[model samples]
Target: MEQRNGRRLILLPLPLQGHMNPMLELANILYFKGFSITIIHTSFNSLNPSTHPHFTYHLISDNLSESEAVEKDLLLLISHLNRKCYEPFRECFASLVSDASKEPVACLISDPVFDFTQSVAESLKIPRIMLRTGSASFTAVISAFPLLQGKGYIPKLDSRLGEPVTEFSPLRVKDLPVINSSDPERFFKLVHNLTYQTKASYGFIFNTFEDLEQHALATLRKEFHIPIFPIGPFHKCVPATTSTSRFLSQDWSCISWLNTQAQKSVIYVSFGSIATLDEAQFLEIAWGLANSKQPFLWVVRPGSISGSDWLEPLPSGFHETLNGRGHIVKWAPQKEVLAHQSVGVFWTHSGWNSTLESICEGVPMICTPFFGDQMLNARYASDVWEVGLHLENGLERGEIERAIRSLMMEKKGDQMRDRLSKIKEKANICLRQGGSSYQSLNDLVDHILSLESLALIKHD
Candidate 1:
């Protein structure tokens, strides 16, 4: 191992909340280990560096500015950012390298989605480490892109949506991320390019523990030549001493409301930052909560429902009917909400971060996955881990009511809670001194120090 020195590391995170959180968490881990951190972010979904004052921040130009009229489609948004980020990033990187007085840039830790960073790092002779924000199972699926493409699964058609992907067992065709695009071929090409980018990097850092996704991580190690580090449920590893939000202000009032409620009574609901539901679905969800007769805390973010900046009025007489039984907010402090004794159930979109946090808190989930790795995460939660239940069928009021009831007041829900407790225990064990995450984190820092030493030797 190289001797400890104050080295600089530049991080490029995909400009989305889900992607940014884990990257920032990783930066926090490295910063504590004596690395000077510089975050190069894009204007679109830009992070407020003031929250992390210890790290230097640079803003690069992006095609999708916060003030500009942006594309509504997720694929189009991603396409624009990927195409626009390269030039600005290159210029900013050059400036960083030219400065000699500051600690030299030792390595570039990039979100796996941003492949262009790999090329820029290589050109600048900086080692690049890829950070995968999703679960190991999802990464395993993504890492097998070549095989999927060869088997004609890349541009999956509507007819084949229900078929099982035999090569990747337990991952049905429906679980595969399907981009809603007019240009399906272009979408497939974009996915293929992004996923393959990780293979070119020096190593990988996954926000997962060893026991949680052992098989998937094992497969990834077998397939890739580089070192793989599983150091996460990151929020637990390093406490969030600083706020890290670009948007979506959190409402803490719900915490008080949760305190007033009975233990194991309130069902906490959130669909994450990006997913938008139509009017019908929104009403169904509202009616379901109301009909379930369970005290609930729901996050109905601005623009959560399609075609409106705010949720269209819920089912008529819904608020009056609930009276003081339900609490609604634009956003809630999710980790705290899950940790509360009153929050017995989590009705979530099954985003990786939310799933992991729920697991850490031992809160069973009612998963209604939206897109991307969520489908796979939901599968792991419900089927593999047996810590959650999948909300089957479309978003109907009756189905939603039934699912909530099943998860909150039934024997199955108790079993899920028990399993979740075990999972939480495992996560705690892995994060302890000399545990899986603890050892992986130490190894990651050692690897980073070695890179710094190599860079210094080359410069000398």
Candidate 2:
């Protein structure tokens, strides 16, 4: 259902499912709004073409194992994208623009990570906008150009004592979500990737509500010259237009089960894809969830419990005892579960999508960031927004139980909840017709379209 806007654009997303999904959604919206979109996928993400035949797909090989990408682990592939994907990517863009079969690229909308894409746009002299598929607070943190490398801000996280991040705003570092960087080498590279790429992007768009992070948004607007647009939930702006086909079905049974529980009586837990927990970590989490005695729903993806037959050994018949009280499943529809009345809190991996989704639902969180910017997300959640609490590094059961109980039952949880609901209200206002985010998106579309008009006028 693509309307003919008589203009062409390139949509480049990173190589992960989370990145691709939002990129696809935005592309779909752009197409429906009448723009021709050429989506570029990494050599590793070539499966996208088969999955989405509607968009024009170009597969460019990068540093990842080319002939067969499945042979390499994801982190290696991501690293390769950072180190070696640029040159091939440039050649591909150049060729596409010169193809003559299609319109010249009027605009380039790239992922936040592919900040290098701005270089491509510059070479072709087309306007570019970086599409950040995450929270406003996280993007603002990057935009702030925080002393991410220095102490008192960067390396001083361990000593934070859950205290406030000074001069940041109404929020503190302790309330924000915190993720653990698995290996030092990868963490630094990823941080460099997030910050440098953002600074390099022409303009950037975030999938978040502006009202929720006023202080952060103010800080970012002052710091960066690139146009910043907050058009989100992103789900709100992008209709389910042609629900891209995928085999996964969200189980609704959990929602029905949740309905039977008391108001905000349940603790909802999930660690997101790509996070792993050993048997000990798994048991600790289980024991904590069990001890809360509050009814709960936990989505335990396969391999979450770790080791074959792992969940079997937990607390000797723990499942049977807690069977009626707790419902654990391999996978459940996260969004719906969050919206359910029974859910009071989320125990999460501090992933951007998960955090934003929880906030959108007005549910608080207990964050344990696994790696990458998840730590940044956790820090903001606890320190900045006051919407969630966090666990220290140990990942022990007592810690898990205590945190969950306090966040769900303690007076502190009530205070956090009050602040969080206010944020959610602000979010609702931003989604209205004339809100900043809505206006920003309208301007973005017009901005891209006008570039082509300018080129035509110059030729005349």
Candidate 3:
């Protein structure tokens, strides 16, 4: 596209914090490549002060009346994305495309959840790409969902002789792979919807690099014709540039605590924004951390533990024992903490964001996934990437302690660390000049620009 003609782009992100965070990165990458981007958000999400805050922030209603209704319409939530988010976006794009200050909007890049976007792109006859925003292992899991029965993992939904969900991928229902859905049934429905949408997208943009996920990458290339571009380590693509805070990214105070720790000495534990533990779970995790006796930073979100008086009261003496050895805060600047020299390991919920962050930092993981495809992501992180340990499915203080201790001093920990360190080098390389991610990112930009150019040609 000629520089004077202007190239305009439309971006749509999932409403959740975890979902919006990566899409924003992709947008920044597009802007750097010289396309004007208009990102669409949900009314539900833009109001949440805690989630990522980027894009022009246009919102749609998911439109479920109650928690029960949301459950029933779970697939709708996952795949349908609100139609209301679209009209405004369409109007915005039309205006921007015609504006004297900007180029005509040519392409649409959206999250799969926002399916209504496809129609908008179609109405304008513009190419729209979906952001996959997950790991290669995760992509493999989704691609292989129908084949899970051949290997005998999860029971077949339709056939008795079918393979289990575990056969095609390393994730399982038992340990760290599930989404901690708060409602398992609802969670599964959401997964089903996302898988279907993958097939629906014109193409997908991933926030990962090729070196970090060779097997998954190879599988996506070999098995699916769906266009999957790995243009990532998106955080690396950004130059530590600051914008107005979109979502309250954890507590900033944790940064000071991290600064004081010794190199590779502290374990960082956080279960993400939505995964809450109960009193029993909380006590188990607390006691486990105490037993490890390793320095750590733990984020304890209010009401993080379910059914607990513990929210109002810290475990007696826990603060005393943990004071110098560890620090507890509601949230922290996670990426910055992950980058710290003292972050020896991570205890996480295995959310995609957490998984990717740990990978970027080269820190080993202790995965205690709560729901979604977490079990699958963790499986790949531990068994595939060799970057982590997956705690037992039903969590225990002793199990958590044992896992932490193993991660800290055990031979397996050392092996995994060395392995992850090598992988980390690859991630760095991928984001560097002429690297896989860098190249892929450029390709994505060129593709979007090509679409915008076509739109301009059509207009002319």
Candidate 4:
């Protein structure tokens, strides 16, 4: 083990699987780079400190009721957390700053969703950096939210759904980001908060690489006027560790099943932790996979199906129809699964983490975006990157089967696979010593160290 530096970084992660995974991975990366880490997390989805024994941990009460904790409305839940966690986080952060025995605090790194952290860090005169756990393309679109709203492009009128957003070429109005909020005003507020708070950060650390999103990164740099570090595909950058930041236990049995299947023959399906499906749509997907006649590994997260606890809503003899062609589990080891030779197509919700994982592994995707940046990610994968197909017309069995055949058994799929192979090569090269991500990471480390000096200058 390397000796730690005298500086410590405080990380505040929003308590969701996608958000937590990248934050923890970045923590590990910084720790290996010789900085001490302190993780201040919420009680809602608290991390197990034992999982990362090297890091110090602090749990600040979010004070959420059982109902608030289980609130299905994502925007509402986040609003609740922001309002509830502000005071507790401020107090906890103050204690860390005033503590005598710990290393001299360097800076604070937090998930951008916790916009409250900016004010807390400002109040303490701490330099704060934000870790944007999404694609640069998504961030660029988000930067345009106010303009989109002003033009009445938001609230997504049916008439404009298919019309291209001329400003954001290749993206239709329907492809714009949206939340499941009945209150458009609240959604707008959330967007404004996320965007401006990001601008307020000392710098940004994106979990993306330059080659993949050079255009988007350029746009963000011009807009935000902050030092932006596109130093990611974070899993590839970090040394492998035993501890997992996953909220659910991964079913490793799928790996065993993959071993028995033919190479590049199986379509691995997962919609991430938060996306849910109605039973009618779920049945369409089930029948679609069956009719595709391709071997598949599907992750049906316990409560992901509407009005059904698990897979009880599956039509009778659903398993027998496939007869060992399909494997279903509550959760999957996604990175491992995507890297498996048998997985040629990833049928996904197009979350940034899953999209990057698939890209790095050279697996093509079938995008079914549920909400938020997923729409943007799916659009980029299908139209921009040409790495996947987008299920544009919602869930239909016939279209699903056709898309599977086109991607699995046709020339178009082969072309997508070929393009993804080259993109994956770029992703790997960027992590090498002379690569963009490598240099960006070096710059980020230097910037982090310089924050102490910047603080002194401000004090004087």
C-alpha TM-scores of all predictions:
0.95, 0.82, 0.84, 0.98
Model 3 residue 353 distance off true place after TM-score fit, in angstroms: 1.9
Q: Looking at candidate 2, what is the lDDT of residue 233?
A: 66
**lDDT by residue for model 4 (1-460), tens:** 4567789999999999999999998998888888999999988988998889989999999999999999999999998999999999999999999899988889999988887898899889899999999999888988898788788888799898998888898899999988877566777787788799888888999999999999999999999999999989898977766455878988999999999999999999999999999999999999999999999999999999988899998988899999899999999989889999999899999999999999999988999999999998999999999999999998999999999999999999999989998999999999999999989988998899899888777657
lDDT of 3 by residue, 373-446 (tens): 67767777787777888885567877887888888888988898888888888888888889988788767766
The local distance difference test score of each candidate is: 0.85, 0.72, 0.69, 0.91
Off by over 4 Å in 4: 458-460
Clash count, candidate 3: 28
**Model 4 residue pairs with clashes:** none
Clashes of each: 0, 24, 28, 0
Ordered list by TM-score, greatest first: 4, 1, 3, 2
RMSD of each: 2.5, 4.1, 4.4, 1.2
lDDT of 2 at 22: 73
Quick one: RMSD of model 1? 2.5
Which stretches of model 3 miss by more than 4 angstroms?
1-5, 47-101, 149-196, 243-246, 308-310, 452-460
lDDT tens per residue, model 2, 326-368 = 9877777777688888889988888887888888788999998
